[model samples]
Target chain A: MTQSHLAPEVMARARDIVALYPHPRSALIPLCHLAQEQDGWLRPEAMAEIAELVGITPAEVLGTASFYDMLHTEEVGTYVVTLCTNIACMLRGAYELLHHAEESLGIRTGSTTADGVFTLEDAECLADCGRAPCLQVNHRFFGDVSPEGFDKIVDDLRAGRLADEVPHHGTLVRTERDGGLRVEAETITAERRATAAAMAERAATAAAASEAKANG
Target chain B: MTVTDAPKIVTSRLGYDDSHTLERYLATGGYEGLRKALSMTPEDVAKEVDAVSLLGRGGAGFPAGRKWSMLRKAPTSYLVVNGDESEPATFKDHLLIERDPHQLVEGVVIACYALQVTTAFIYIRGEFALGLERVTAAVNDAYGHGAIGRDIFGSGFSIDIVVHPGAGAYICGEETALLESLEGKRGFPRIKPPYFPAAIGLYGEPTVVNNVETLSNLPWVLSNGSAAFTALGEGRSTGTRLFALAGHVKNPGVYEVEMVKTTFRDLIYAPVLGGGIPGGRELKAFIPGGASAPWFGPDQVELPLGQDEVGAAGSMLGSGSVVVMDDSTCVVRAAWRITRFFWRESCGQCTPCREGSGWLEKILRRIEDGEGRESDLELLMDISDNLAPGVSWPPQQTTICVLGSSIPSSIASAIRMFRDEFLLHIKDGSCPQGPAPHG
Candidate 1:
């Protein structure tokens, strides 16, 4: 049964995510990603729906959700601007950009704007040290960002002029799969299965031979 | 010596036009290593790698071949590439993932074959959207080319790779914690002795966890033979390493240098690398590794860049992230920012790390803000000692992961090396550098 909070397509995708791992519990993180992908944030009902789908309790889902910095459990703005103020970025004038951001938005870090447009956060390290003083608008990077560049980005997003610039929070990347490599248990062919068995035998023999050689 | 003088094995094809594409990868005679590896027995492949002494580039510098051999030759073995390059001022893995993803893919596939890992995962960090996109595209391309997935190149061996994107946790950079995060839980590091990823990991099955850069070296090592690879570097610490330069450097980027053959001084001063610190400012201190490593003064700049040499010089070559600070930069402020990063990123699984990092951040902040107490320095050391007992080298008696140990590494080192500046902060009851906080 599809939950009211989750789209049918999203629920199906969640099931597919669960199938990615050997155990359903292993799908918890990905399923949360799916939930956030659909709703932009993990609401209480959304978490409950995901927990039920993954055969876990809502509390367990929340516990996992709260642990990750990305999987927000509350409401946020359409555009989440995360500025890296960690050691590397801090060295490269990231704090100045942060103060600039705070001034431009008229909102401090960790708070959303009154217009419900932007949510600014002071992130630790986005790990883009090569291009220091970086920021991410809805999880996509704006590398080597300047105060003026950040302002233009904000203005563009506000005006919806930068339509394709920033992806939503949970949209990690755009990938087109031609449907190669069927790894699921249901898709293992008979020939492939026989080959897998032979490979295991070969591995054992090869390992034993190597160990003998080492000992000698 | 310049970074160009070092053999560039891992990043050889880094800037080639359309390098991320499989077609371009093939034009440069890529996947020949996978083909060569496929011709040999898995054990023989592992043996060759062991002969090369390919060290793990993911901070710990563990032997990659030894790690592969340690895996139980089972069909259930899993290969998880730790693409979570979350350490502050470190982005070498980011360079690999974004620029030459197929190198990582080819290397990972070869590793899976040798270690008998049928399924693999590349846990890219959340912020790296382009990396995620590029790696995902590369994996898909690998599948399309029959490089990975069922009966690889008609060898009758089958394996599949999946790109798993992590949702931002620095602690997940630790191997066990990475596995925990991969298994869809909080990024809490599993206690060792009872839990190592190789023997028992990922659903209590045999798993091999390697760094992106470490795996990316396999194709080169396998193709070129072990001797050719090992000839480039000093004893045991074989092969070239990617050193990321940042903070007051003229050219702040990733550079490949031979292990131990290159010195920190050369890395910073060579015109081809860091280019002698930006703005002609005198170098005061630098963290040879990422933020977690102990900071060293200018007197020790000649220390070798190898893991052993740096360790002997009372610092680590951890992750090979060299963050330089000029004389104009305040040590107390730098220490506070670094400590604050550890504080914010602590997973809170271990009490010492969780509480101790917070305490360190608060104390350092107070000291930097000119609210220093005379007793606070001693208290900071005491807390660091509690987190990493004795404040010794190769930090010990901490949490499930070395993150607890990492918390005190820079803090204790900063207090020891720049005690005078910290004392000045206390004596003056404010930042001694000037009105500006960062300077």
Candidate 2:
């Protein structure tokens, strides 16, 4: 690897996530988020470390990371403010909220502020539809937000009033657990081998079935 | 006549302020369902769920009992609870995950007992910060309660539930797509043919993927016999369904009312419910279900909120999200916004969804921006027809998953119900109502 981006402790936590699943690859997305949480975006170094941790290629990691809106490959602000302008939110003054936020932030959607503290995006449905016109700051949701409400939250955020709750952009969940589901390392390795064999067998079965269909 | 609203089954634990806490959950007979399910054999428990006819709440309305039964015959290895509720105006699962996480945990536990699965994962939307926290805590609390993990409740059914966070993809809300995301891949849905989760699923083993709301219902179903659950809502809809009412409603919120028996009118107009539209506005149209469902005009307000009844009405109550739009609302603008949502969230794997969604959104944008040609109307429909061929109700899909099929609903519903609005936009070179819908 070019460099070790994750610290010893951070690497342990990443390993903890890997242990939670029967297959280590299942930890890939979570680790991607964790890497972003550490660096605000997925760095090549972090992605390389993750690939090493999960036994996947860096290119493979990028393929997965690029697919999600939240996992960014490039730079992002410390706080990502995504205003929902989808159906429910749009009908509930989301555009107005967006207009106001744009004016207040002095930056358009999809651009970060001069301070690099905030990045604004006009997002899709954030699942806070009952309280329409929702926006998420660093994945923390704020629903039923008016222009004034959005402005107020921004001020609070800038003033560091809401810093404790509104963390840096990728820290969605911070709940520490006693432990995760852990099976022995050898058991997981064996299971992976078995799963690979099963997959190959299924592929053979499908090939034979297709061949039979063609012959018939 | 609409039947009187039934007692809440799934949302029974919702009203209490501390309802999310494990203490509150235990005090309010939280793990009773897990206890009750443990008392019965796995087969018996599965039978009880089957007797209730509990359809999946995460759209598709597949019977939960049937899903488990299918997995029961196979060597099912995992139970993944879908908590990824990202549909516009759909927050029932979010509410369940955030407000009564312990109840959800209890439900997941009961599901494990019935399915006899060892490891279950709760894949919650990553956007839900509080929900992730609560569910994470709730899962841990369940383990402490002996509801999950090692020899749960001394019933000899040990299970582990991991709450996995989704990084932000609406397509991941789809079942197989969810599996792909859980497996740490892109949220592209697996092409269907040998396409049954009961056959091949997570890690190439049989897996039962159920919704959070569907699993949350199990605690209630286990405690109050399946007969009691079945006796509530009519036909296929056999319980109080959580309807998240949004848009122009005065009191927009998630209300649990008897399915099929309750009308959209009651949910949106009743004083105890939506309390009618805000600003004394006259209702123009409403999306009967989620944003994907073809909308219902005011004339269809009396349509029952049931799987069959709504399905018969050309739009399935797909995600239990009812969005009302009033007379002052610009249908063109609203349709554009909905189109934009689909376009932005198309996952970019399928050509029709990837290219078609962007094409549809651009057309809507130009129309809304007053740069419309009358031909644009036909173009929208043509493209919609291309993606969802025939543009018929119970849409035909050309893409891997339903997201491509879903793009046509808003466009078709607007044109079918409000052609004049589109014509007005074209004739006036702008939306006659207003360019800005609510802002």
Candidate 3:
């Protein structure tokens, strides 16, 4: 699985994502996601490729990638079980549920199982508060779960019964979009010039205001 | 009109199975608002929104129309739809996006028309995989149906919407931080004064950042007119609003109700709403707003869900999330969990928020685990007050964003309301209430 280059298809998709933004540097986070999708973890070579794609250094890519919890710099197991222990979930036996997940998965909250098939995390709120004690299997949600319900979910996932609904790690947005407007070459050029002029004017105005305050 | 009598506006199309599709959306009188908005001038459309007095639903209760008015007019102003609903127990936007995405898409196009902008971006949280998929499919379907892209609906107004996905970071929900993330950088919130989206924003250009729920109401506003919406709810809190009810309630879900007409008691106890606490247990306390708000005891249940009313009563109806706690619940554990969330999501841009959140969480956890001194409570107050002086509801912080100040809310509220319970944990050296949680 180790490689110095991103797969040809992923490179093509990366180029498409880059087109959606006005600046190539704006594509760094999405390219990081793309690299994670290609490999389970963000490999050094993949990060180098992304840095080259977005016109930044590899260290800069790593610095930004490390800031996010979803973009893993380290390797993750097959099923990343992220359980919520926030206020809403905690009010609903989330601690007990978390304890159950630890026991059944044979790993601690931030550790991986022996088979490397599952990595459990005590996540913050996933924003689905109605379904308390909610957990995610590689970012897909399961809610209103009890300790027994958690065990059953693990069993189903282990036996590959829920493979159709759940995909591998780093696989977000199962559906593809119909492509963005991407403005148009003429509009992009025009908008870029307009934005540059506005920024220059704004800087000039700020400098004048500061100078006036100093004089007073 | 009262809460029970007010008409459903934003959530009018929910509960239908095929509500997300363009076919079902067109069949159900969707995008008619866009058609009607196209017939009028952009100024007139903004005038309709101004007449409605709709407040922003993303924590801060600023008026949406006034926010649009403040946007610096330029040839290339951008409109960003903030669907990054990352706060705990705040899921109204999640529901609006998951079930009725076409409505949201229609709302975005309508907003673009009012702002007279040609490009927009819908930044949804990354954890919402299905919601992201549905909204993406809806945007594509919208393009195919000729509701978006060049010369929309043959009115010669062109617009482009990019469905941007966030890699998991809660701080990106902040509008300025969202812009930073959109530009592919760490999501540290920018300082205000010159950084308010109306002045300097995304890519150093003027931008209008509207919450998902606020924009979702635009279709209804245009469809029924501003007078129709303003007539439903009274005073500053005009039009119906969505509230996400969670925690100990039996029917914990999102409900669209009138703004000032509804009281906390009705929302938490109504048969069709929260459906009361489970197991016939008595209510102990509740968080009237989102997790960041101070907790309210049972006596404050009669206060109406109005921004002015709640603010006068020493809290805010932030993010429209109400969490209830039954008599069996442990207040210390609940407060500790909330503090823990703030600690995890502090973004580390400021020393007060990052370091303060961690210290607060550690101390709350210790007290919850019955390893507390009576003086630990005072120490908690001292640590919290250092971050936000006075430890009051309208927070004053030592850091850039309000998150640093928000660290004090739960602990301060717990100490103010239930000082004796913390003493019991300290005196008895164990939790008297035990692990009594709700689902």
Candidate 4:
């Protein structure tokens, strides 16, 4: 590699992620997600940097990146707009939203605007069946969007009126777990184990008998 | 007549105050099942699940207890919870993870305790940002309460759950592909017969891969008796299922229905379910399952919404995603859209899926774009035959995974059901009804 592209802190976090799994190679996808979040896309240099961190070749990294759809191998715009045009969305005016987006942005489905601000693409199902015609800006969900709604969001985004709507790549929602954890010391007596073992023997025999009857 | 609406088991706490929090989950007696399972032996826990006849809710409807029984007894077994709800029109698992994240964690704790598994992974879909965040925080909250870490509930049972997000691959919903993605590889389906996840999966150890909804039912099965769980439905298809109703319905949302109790008519026309088709239009056809499932005519609306009945009616109850299409919808265009999904999502590992899906899309696009020949109809069927090679309900194909069959299921069914529509396109050189179906 020419020079170390990843920041020192990013590299330190990458090492910690690698340490999470027993096999370091299992951290390849997470590390790639980290690099893309930093660079907005997976650049060749970023791939090389990740390969160094994960102890694998750059080609190995590319092979995995190319397989997944979200990992961009090339440069993307600042705001990546992905509209779900799959079956459920299509039934609820997704094509209209896509066509409206194409006309308003002056770009095709898979192309970016000339200003390098918006990249538009038709995505598959976003798993928001309740809200059809959904779209995502940098993977954040905007459900039940109409053409007018689409234009309004774009206008707000361009004008910086709604900055928090579009987060950086790979950043999802922001929520933390609450503190009232349930733990009791008196419940763990030796008597419970004996009762549990006897129940297990009866359950196993019943399961075996049922298995035989089903096979028969 | 509509089937009586049963109480929501999975979504019971959906709209409760602080539903996604560990506090609310605890107040509702969430980890009581895990605590009970920890008190019992692992085999008994598996038996309790088996007794309930809880089928995998992530499509395929395989018995969860049978899957647990097939564990290879390896010392290093792993539990993989599939939250990759990417089946088009399906979002029940997404709701489960977002609304009741700790419910899934509690299920994982019990499952790992039963299988003696230490390491478990929740493979959430990459597109699901809210789900990922909710599940991540839930895992942390679980750890804080000693619900997931060593000596859970002070029962000396240890399990750790890692929330791993997928990077935009629809095929990763397949259990084998999910395992491959967990190993940091391309999400490709492993060949069967030798590579079942139970025998060899996730770092070459015995693995149990259960769907999010399937695992979420564990706490219920362990808390209530197996007979109580089974009494909710009929026959082998017992327990409640989360049905994601979308498309031309007035109320397009997820509903929990007893497996054998609910019917297609109830899901589509019942006021409590789909609220009947939108605009009061006559239902022409609908996908009984996800897009991969074949389209069924309105005559089959009375069919029960279960695996056996739906499969007998020539469509699998896949992911329980019902996408209704009114008479205003064009059948040929719908088939093309579904076919294009399979074509794009094909992993390119198998020849039939890679090449066959693309060719089917091109032909359908040509037919839809008003540049069609009568022979293109025969050509589409021929291409479908080459991919699946049978007209059976579950076509006998030669691809690595069901994704190969998915390419032809919608196409073959559309041609069989709407030959006149295809002929009209060829006759008029376009969609006879309109110009390319705007919206």
The prediction achieving the highest DockQ against the true structure is 2
Better of 3 and 4 by lDDT: 3
lDDT per residue as tens, model 2, A1-216: 544688777898999889787788899988988888788889999999899888899999999989888888988898899988887888888888898998899998889998899999888788888778888898888888988888899989989999988999777688865534446789999999999999999999999999999999
Residue pairs with colliding backbones in model 4 are none
User: How far off is residue B256 in model 3, in Å?
Assistant: 0.7
Candidate 2: which stretches are off by over 4 Å? A1-3, A179-216, B1-5, B72-76, B433-439
Q: Candidate 3 regions off by >4 Å?
A: A1-4, A182-216, B1-3, B433-439
CA lDDT of each candidate? 0.84, 0.86, 0.87, 0.85
True-structure RMSD, every candidate: 8.1, 7.2, 7.3, 10.7
**Tens-place lDDT digits, model 3, residues B31-142:** 9999999999999999999889989989998999999999998877899989999888899999988888989999899989999988898998888889999999999989
For model 4, how does the per-residue alpha-carbon lDDT over A1-216 read when each residue is reduced to its tens digit? Answer: 544787787788678677667677788888888888788889898899888877889999999999998899988888889999888898898888899999999998888888889999888899886899899998887888988899998898889876776676655434433322224545655557768998999999999999999999
Question: In order, what are the TM-scores of chain A for the candidates?
Answer: 0.80, 0.81, 0.81, 0.77
TM-score of chain B of 4: 0.97
Each candidate structure's TM-score, on Cα atoms with residue i matched to residue i, is: 0.92, 0.93, 0.93, 0.92
Give candidate 1's error at residue B329 in angstroms: 1.0
Give stretches of model 4 more than 4 Å off.
Answer: A1-3, A172-216, B3-5, B433-439
